[model samples]
Target chain A: MTTMPSFDQWMKAVQAEMEDALLRHLPATQQIPVRLHEAMHYAVLDGGKRVRPLLVHAAGALFDADARELQRAAAAVEMIHAYSLVHDDMPCMDDDALRRGKPTVHVQYDEACALLVGDALQSQAFDVLSSGNLPPERQLAMVRLLAQASGSLGMCGGQAIDLDSVGLQLTLEELERMHQLKTGALLRVSVLLGALAGKALNDDETAALDAYAAATGLAFQVVDDVLDATADSATLGKTAGKDAADNKPTYVSILGLEQSRALAEQLCVDAHRALQPFGEKARRLRELADLIVQRKA
Target chain B: MTTMPSFDQWMKAVQAEMEDALLRHLPATQQIPVRLHEAMHYAVLDGGKRVRPLLVHAAGALFDADARELQRAAAAVEMIHAYSLVHDDMPCMDDDALRRGKPTVHVQYDEACALLVGDALQSQAFDVLSSGNLPPERQLAMVRLLAQASGSLGMCGGQAIDLDSVGLQLTLEELERMHQLKTGALLRVSVLLGALAGKALNDDETAALDAYAAATGLAFQVVDDVLDATADSATLGKTAGKDAADNKPTYVSILGLEQSRALAEQLCVDAHRALQPFGEKARRLRELADLIVQRKA
Candidate 1:
């Protein structure tokens, strides 16, 4: 048999697929409120690592899920991520001027358009996921899962905690809890939804996948904190050292750079261990875990 | 048989039920990001006419739909409405200080909190609808319908047109098209979703309901423009005449007050005519059309 494609090859292909799918799913910029649609396209296209969609594709591959359905789920999750970024970078939130190595949505567009883009993107995400090749029941589950993941109890809740924790010292437990809800929830859901787009996993298999997702999710945040501290803005594609500048609590702030790096590595190890049951089928997931903890930006 | 409740009594009951359902659906303030939850509660509760919910209940009553399912649908639509109002009143949008006769969300809370409240409330609305007593497929349909109604093609799109049209002259057709998507889309969905919570309607019945919703929806906006010109801020429970102040085009601006009032009456008549198929079952809806056209606030 031919050798398996490298992780980089896999990522390149999936990224292309995701970009195309997102373009197809987004309203044409020529539509009414052309500016809003243009802003939405600007916010989502030609930007950022498609990490969420990659995780979705990687997990779905094991089950040989329907490709079209997988694309819908992948697009939906990435849309959520994009909308969150758009809103988070608003003047009322992080107030960042740059993202994905370009002007942020609110900076390139106006604040009102940024706000509407976020809102419209979110509604479109749900709209895309609600109807696809999947069974109606499964689609409903996807909607419920995504709604919960993005809502107050998940990413939004985590954001609230993050905002409140600013300028305040947070314990390791508190920081992890906040990250778990904020980034971790959506990341985990990405994997689960990817898996869901295919054959239903047995309870044990789903549990293992959930464990892998949770560990890698946290690891992703830990590395993010480390990068925010260590990387330059050009390399990171976002404002560097923003956490420290804003007095926001981060892993590096609480544990220092060296210890935070160690923690990310440990979490990656935990993520890999959680995938032991899947063995070779989870090779991609394993590679992703390593990539998350070791990326330069 | 006991006489059916009067329109006033029916309104009182549905309003109370909707209030209770909204409270039940909102996140408890004890949760983390308590402030966001508090703001969400403040934005939704003890405010507004609950007109959307009333329409939902009235339409559901026609089909003898499940009360619990209808309650969820009603609450979801109202939550969407509330969130839109919150976002629209933000500094970047309308910059209004009063809504529903009290401080707007951005005024009561900070702009950031107001933003988050709108986002979270929207998520919660979908969450509430996704797992209600209805079948999974129906729930999926509700999710899809609401998503379409609220997304860029609908309310958000209309708002964008509104924002863009400021200081620009929009023809009567363009203004009508904008209102159809903005207010009309949600109003139509409110009735459609309520009817959907019960047995599905045949095409003719669905078409009739859609026409009723469309006409009544436009009539609602027409009356709103008239009231905005005639009523004071205190009486209107919002910053009245702000449409003129902002130089936004309206029915009053395009058709003149007399013509607009005439249009409202004509639409009300059309709404009543569309309900003949439902006969006495549509009495509440018939009363609602009259109430909507005649209400001062």
Candidate 2:
């Protein structure tokens, strides 16, 4: 009998798969208007933890889906994540100079190019997601899902709330709602979309996976808050303490370090509990919840 | 027999239909993030001439397509157009203050809000387009078409080239190339997507419509150049002569005003010629080509 791969080994393999898919899917830098392509490449490649794509793969594997199609969906989600990061780091938004230990797109290139890069990346993500081997009906469902996750009712709406909430106190419920729309929307969709790349799941299975994803998504952000409060820039690969510095409300700010840590652990338990229905098929997702809560950075 | 509506009447009716569709399709401003929704509504409503949507309606009408589906497709295209205008008018790009005789999005709202508005609008466009009554196959095709027309190979690529070409003289070929990607792409897609909303056309009919659209799309830009050069800000509903002021290349700047006028007329003739097969069914399209050239603004 084959033993399951180590967590590190699984991560490395999925990361390589995602990297290859991204390189294959992105526009060639040699194309005309090379600067735009270059900026797009800079924004996406050799960066980030590939968390969303990994979630996509882990969830996709539950249904014994085609790896090739999962790679496409994974690449698409990563592109959307990258585009959001690029835009959020723009001068008018977060004005973050460093991301993933490199200068942000708007800092490396001009703001206009950064804006265009985000726009082009978004269009390309939908294009890639809706094409490939998925049946037309399934593809359409995926397109609608991604679109909803990315749009006003989801990420963007959450961002607007975040921007508005700066310097203002938010109740726990309000903060939860905001995070649900902002980061949670995309993370949950990543798992759902990954599963979608495979065979159809029963309603119960879909709900269980969604609950697992939703808990893990919030847990990820809660840990991010913990890291921001405890870690330094070198460890985080981005400016640490920017949340408090910007007067942005965070779990650490509201709940203090120990409580936030406790909350994150509780979320991890919830995430793992939700995956009980999937049995050992959800081992990777369970592992991800642990990693998210326990990571130092 | 019922008498066909005059050009004025047809324009008014389609404009009204598009307006109602946009209102029906856009996210209501009373939602949680009211400001973002308001900004989106402001960016889209009470704005520029509904040329693209009109093209969609005119093209879709050829095969007696469902009016409801045509409206959804038209509204989707218009949302894209509106979002582009909002971003293009941002401080990093054209930095225009006025559009359709009012402050541009970034001027009306803050730059951050404008940025989010544009991003949300784009996502919402894809969401609305891919949903609704259209078949999944047709919707997927529409999604792909819009994505291609909007991405690096199309509008954004053209805008990047335009950004780079400032203060530099470009050959007529280069100029046409930029316009083809920038303005021409969305315009052509408006016709094609509108056609796709209806019954599938024979190859000959498809080719003819494409040819007609290509000519008219270029003609629209040429006429825009003429208007930018000669019309006042009040009449044009945007800053006049800004292209020249910004040192951006235009047909009037490169080909001379008289030659540009002749080119526009020639394109209009070509547009009419391509529609010979459609006979009376092509009347609105043919008239639109004439109006595009002759409109003072």
Candidate 3:
């Protein structure tokens, strides 16, 4: 077998690719409704760790997916992530002034512009995913997966539950359900979208991928909770400890800091186990599980 | 030709169908993210003119579309319309307390809930449109059309322009472009989606439908401008004279009230002429052009 780039090298390469892909799909700053286009560009470009793109590329690697298709898929998922962050940072929501180590969209632009940026970015995501020369069924499938993941029963639902749960204690079960819907659903779909971008997988393999994504999703959130508790705002690139400050429940809130760390690690191990069916071909996926839990921010 | 429902009868039946279709696709309030679901229902159900749905069904009638397919298309468009209204009424946007004779989503619930409800409903629209047993290509077409119509170049883009244009004077050309993007694009797409719900259209027929929708869309806006200036809050169901009060440009702002009414009448004639290709089968679409321009509300 050909040698693969080290995880760091692969990640850096994919990040660069995502930058180009996202730029290509976004409306230019010079476009009509110039301010809106500028804000959309600002919200999406030159920021974020791009965890979703990394996951998409890693998963795409397993199926020998075309880089072009994966680029579109990666960009679409990242746009959704960026849009969510834009809205979540709004004064009506988290009311945060910072995101990705920069002023949040609402702080940089007005709140109305920020809202339009988020809404426009979402439409752009679907447009990018379904725009190219992919098979009709595959395109439709990807669109459906994304719509469902982003819909009421998924990310937005989680946001709603989070909104209601502020200042109130949530059980461990409730917290898990919230995270599963909010963060987990999108992450899982990122993997599935990557796979669907290339060759189809069998039932056994699909389930294995689902399991890997599910475990990894939980690990990512748990790690986020731990970081929010342990890291400073500078390191976190956002308002660290904002969850606890807002009286919002999170993995760390329910499981305690040390237990959350342990749970994240355990979840990482479970993610690795879920990749057994793919053997060595799943190395990128396996590495992601580790990175998700081990990263400082 | 078979006896058809009168315009009043046809519109009433389709409005009822849209209510059922919208409810069927929405997450039940008892669902996991109960608050979000509840807000989504509150924002969408039992409100609005259902104009987009009416346009969808009217256009579908010309194609002899399946009622089921038209139902899904109509509901999806209405969901989009509802979500836009929810966002438009937020404190950051128009900050209005009333919509469709009831408290706005943000007024009834909260700003955060309104945001989530709008977002969740947008996702639900795509989900509902893509979920059924329609042909894959047609489904993909409808999706792409909706995404394009709602994206940076479409409805949201128009909103951004409107946000930018408040208290500014716009030339007649600029005003038309703004309306075309903001409200006209969605209206045009509603017609296209309805027609797409049935059999495919040739280039000539498609062009004719596009023209028909364009004229109707503008006429609808012109009528809105007139109503906003002439009607009271109780009759309009929204705050009356909002455009004038907000200093936002409208047809009435650019043209004298007399000219605006003349424009609407001329556009209605154009709409009827565009339906010449469809002959008698285009009755519903022809009837809708009149309703849009003639409605007291």
Candidate 4:
């Protein structure tokens, strides 16, 4: 039997790969506005676990895709994530003073600078995708997928719902719907983009990956909710109890701690089953899904 | 000689063409988020002169390009303009309560909604370009052009400078540099995209179009500054005299009123001369430059 790679080792390898990829793609262009580039580099290079980019790279590696090709896709996804966090922390939105244990963009810079940085980063995501060395058809598909995942029907739309529903008791279904759009959409896109970056997948394989992404995406959120409830600031790397302090709706809030944990475990199992067709090719993805649910931070 | 179209008649023609073109392209797809569509419609259909779209159409017509094929390009440019305006009006930005006498997006809905709408609109501009009937290479080129024009080096960058430089006295050169990126980038893109939408232009024609766009764009801003200083709210259709009130830098602020007016007239003449090769074929463009500098409102 093949020995399982240590989770820490795998994460470290992927993080290095992702960092190299991001740096390779984000060359300082004389034409790019200097301040804009500074802000983008500031937010993107700010330390965080390279989880989304790792998922992308791991999924691509499962199919024996080119590592360098997958790197651009990975960087693009991470850029989107960074941009979302920047905007989410704005005064008008979540009003987060801290992110990843550091002052949030708006707090670190003025609100207007933070806002423009987020806007620039968001636009840069599409810019990188469209301008990167991808075929036109693939570029078009990637743009469309990222747009759907980031726009109203995806991340931004989910944010609107979250803003509207803040401080209100939400049903389990409503919470799931919100999380699906807010987090699940981009997470699924991460996997979908990886598959697209690799060789084309048959309908069955695509469906299986979709199922896996869907389950794991929700499981990731459940774990986040659980951590938010249980973990302290140092461990979580952000304000631990802000959700509850703000009276925000969460899976744990709606389903109780035990129930939420149970749901997460169930989803992880479903995710593993979804990867069954890929056999050993998807072993890393399976482990990643489990790690997501089991994560304490 | 064909009687020159009256200004009102010309505007009505452009408005009808813009509406028809937008509707033709905006298919009723269930997949598209309804709220996004509503926001796009709200901003696009909000009354304005449609000058950007007009410039696209007129520039294409000068090359005898198919009017039908140019519609998508026209709509795409307008959408970018509209989205920029929405974001520019946010509380953290210009904080304008009204745009063209109607409540700004943030005032009409909320800051979150307005931000999302702007994001959607910006992404949708790319979507239209990518999914339109243009060749893949052409679409890719258009996407790059639009991204560069709308991105940090272009409109957004311009806005950032404007925000940062507020209340500080600016030199004429500095002011011109700001407007070049802000308004002139899109204006140049308007004409270049028109040429790209038509049969591709040779280097000479492309260079001339750039010159035309730059001169006319600067003239447009000079006239705007002049109007802000002299016009009333009723005629301007939005807050007037607010620029001087805020101590915002403008051409009239940096140069005296007479010098500013002289600069605008000189730019208009340069704009007309840039189209000399096309001559009467660009009569409408020449008329537009004159009208922009001479308009009371």
Candidate 5:
């Protein structure tokens, strides 16, 4: 077996690629409405691990994907993620004051600006997908997939559940269902879109990628819950224990910390195993799966 | 010269067609989230003049268009309008309590539910466009046009301006620019989409329809400003004179009531004249344009 890269090295590579991809896809900040553009750049360019785009790019790399094509898809997914964050941090939602070690969009700008910024970014994702140089059929597929993943049936639905679960004791199954929709849906879409951008995949390849994405998505969330419980504010670059403080339902809350950690590891293993069909060709995807459950923040 | 139908008769026809179209497009509220679905139904089904949808249908008819095709386009435009109202009514934006003689979506349901409902409706509009039996190329064009019209360059951009313009004096030109983006973009899109649905139009037909939509759209807003100045809540079916109360910059504020009224009439004339090529076939559209500027509320 080829030696695996350290998680830090992998993350550094991912972060650089993400920044380049985002810069390339986004319109120059000076061109859009000043405040709206600023909020878009601020929300997206703020420091985060760039996990979603990484998953997209890494999954595409497994298939020897076109670099520019994958970049657009990666950037679009990140835009959607940023938009969700802006909306989620609003007073009507999670009411977060901090994100990625900086003030949340609403806190930094007015709430109306934050809301409009999110709306603009969300529309921008579809704009990117629709405007991309892909063939019409492929473009339609990408638009439909991303829309489904981002819309009420996916992340938004998950958010609704999360909002409802606040101050309520949610079972492990319920929390899992919520996360599957909220987080897993987009992650899965990212991988699927990346694979689609590369070449059409047969049923087996599609199934395997879906399984890998599903496992890694859940593992990613499991690790996130663990980090929330254990990481310090500086380490997390945000409010570390906010979930527990808000009495939010989380993997740790439902499964206990030890069990949650075990589940994450198992999920990572399953995610890596799902890539067996791709063999050594999917090295980056396998590495990503491994890194997902191991990261501290 | 052919005698024109009475304004009341034209309005009855548009209203009947609008009700039918709305009923046809929306699924049963029983299937989705109870509160959200109910709120959506309440917002759209509640009696309003259905101005946007009527414009879409009338514009389609101006080309001897298919009734069924026009209905779909009409429903799509109205759905977008409804979704915007739902979001605009949330606490973070306009914070209005009343809309169309009923409580605003956020007031009727929780703010979270209102937000999600708006999102669902927005997604649903695209869903209708893409999923209909329309040809793939037509569907793609429709989606692209609607996205641009509803997106940053369109209604949302106008809304951002409106948010920024509050408590500020905007010049007549600036107010026109804002309204053009805010209301005029969607209105123009409605006409363009109708032409598109009727099979691609020649350049002259397209140009004529665009001119018609542009004038009618601005006239629609001017009448809205006039109504806000002179009408009561009972006549308007929502808060009236709120613009003056809030010191919001509007056509009436910038040009005074007499000039605004004259401008509305001139716009209606220009809109009707743009449809000269369509002759008697454009009668419905011509009447709709006059009704828009002449309506009491």
Candidate 6:
């Protein structure tokens, strides 16, 4: 706690902490309905970029949030992210056979188990979020935020839009709205949940964080679109150029690869600008914005 | 209410109130991702007996809970119930085309839409439950209650067990455990949610309600087993006698129809005895127990 850990060390620490947090929070595989619990473990553990948890921890650092509280918040958001990925990969949806360099839940287990695992994980997210040292009111607020981000008007709503937009041309405004709900909502909530774990924000602080989150959230997807178009399967970890292959609308598809890359950069600038009021307190959040835009995958 | 409306009238009134409440609480069709929202409405509205809501209202009556809070709780539980049915009817699960005499969500919409609808509706359940006149602590408690009943250790876990048990003979104890987690959990929570809306209960009161709910909850499935064996599709409003065809174990499959009927009767007696502490305040609960055990469908 004397000198700061390097950025890579800090991120690895956060990721490692979340690995333990998610494992401890998830229902034990030893529980009855062992297969389902095991699959829940399978779907959540040892997977994904852990980007959502990273944001939670970084935003939490701004206000010096309680360590255990931040861990729970980060795990809860990651669970929501994980469950969405599980459902989105179902045969009736994306039909993907792989995720995180491993067979997808529906492919590894059966589709029914995948469905149940996703449903149960979503429940587990709320269960974990509503527990712990936070005041009851805070717990209720956290639950509300998680539900609103996950519900019809948020991530699921965004996915429905994405599903319908397949092979169709969407205007930039429409695509932005879709991404805002689909991917942006959860990303933004990760920051808010992190901050909430420490203390409620005043209006100006809330507005600043929202602006930063909005910029970084969109930047994350913009980078994703760019990586999908420009990177190889080996680099990206999933299929490369799949959006264009599937004829799904994406920033790269709509804006072209060059313009999509430019948009991501612009979003990064906006995110950095939004944190000027916080100065040094916003270091992790600032670095995260850059990482989101500049990541190769 | 002053004159004490007849039980039939009271039941109708509660149903009417719930229909309106659900309509108001569910996301509107005009929302973006309109199809998903519309399907959510279709899955929840104008379907099945409002047995869970009835239990919520009945339990709320014991504590004279706020009517509006009870409505939110009732709708929340019903949404949870509705989502479970939607997912359970998918091709990967029970694969039923018909539910409550209408095409199932997956059949009416596409399977993907049904999946999203179920996921969104589950989030909506928490959204609605956590938003009302109740204190924040109460809302958090209710959310926790709903999640426990709906998550791996609850409804979904029961389903995984059911999926594994198909075509296999189950012992009576195993069958009871499955049913307890499956339908019993939600039904029991309906009563608990109702009572929770009134105010927190003392240990004795909670025990009384739990005993009553546990008995009636099991009796519900027992009667369902009996009816599935004897009732026609039209009488049941869905396919009947399909359980045996599917090789799923039920109370009547292990015990004779006569014994299942006798068990239902015994449960009804237990339910009634459990309500003795509340005397006149328990009238709706008492009637609900008889309704559950004696209903033809």
**What is each candidate's DockQ, to 2 decimals?**
0.79, 0.84, 0.85, 0.47, 0.44, 0.88
Residue A108 lDDT (model 3)? 93
Q: Give candidate 1 regions above 4 Å deviation.
A: none
How well does candidate 4 match the true structure in TM-score terms?
0.92
lDDT of 6 by residue, B214-297 (tens): 899999999999999999998888889889999999999999899999999999999999999999999999998998887988
Per-residue lDDT over A1-297 for candidate 1, one digit per residue giving the tens place of the 0 to 100 score: 899899999889989998899999999999987998999999999988888998999898878888888889999999999999999999999999999889998889899999999998889998999977687777788888998899888998898888889899999999999999899989998999988898766899889999999999999999999888888999998899898899999999889999998998899989999999887888878889999988998
B166-225: candidate 4 lDDT, tens digit per residue: 889888888999999889999899888877887667889988999999999999999999
Cα RMSD, model 6: 1.1
Q: Which stretches of candidate 6 lie over 4 Å from their true place?
A: none
> What would the per-residue lDDT of candidate 5 be over residues A113-212, giving only the tens digit for each residue?
8877777777677667666666666666777788778766678778777887899998888888889989999999999988888777789998999999
Q: List the candidates' TM-scores in order.
A: 0.98, 0.98, 0.98, 0.92, 0.92, 0.99
What is the TM-score, restricted to chain A, for candidate 6? Answer: 0.98
Off by over 4 Å in 5: A1-14, B1-33, B62-72
Judged by DockQ, which candidate is best?
6
Against the true structure, candidate 3 reaches a TM-score of 0.98
User: Candidate 3 — which residues are off by over 4 angstroms?
Assistant: none
Model 2 over residues B144-255: C-alpha lDDT tens digits?
A: 8898899999889999999999999999999999999898989988998888898766799889988998899999999999999989999999999999999899999999
Candidate 5, pairs of clashing residues: none
Query: Per-prediction fnat values?
Result: 0.67, 0.75, 0.82, 0.41, 0.26, 0.85
Q: What is the docking quality class of candidate 1?
A: medium
Could you give the interface RMSD of candidate 2 in angstroms?
0.7
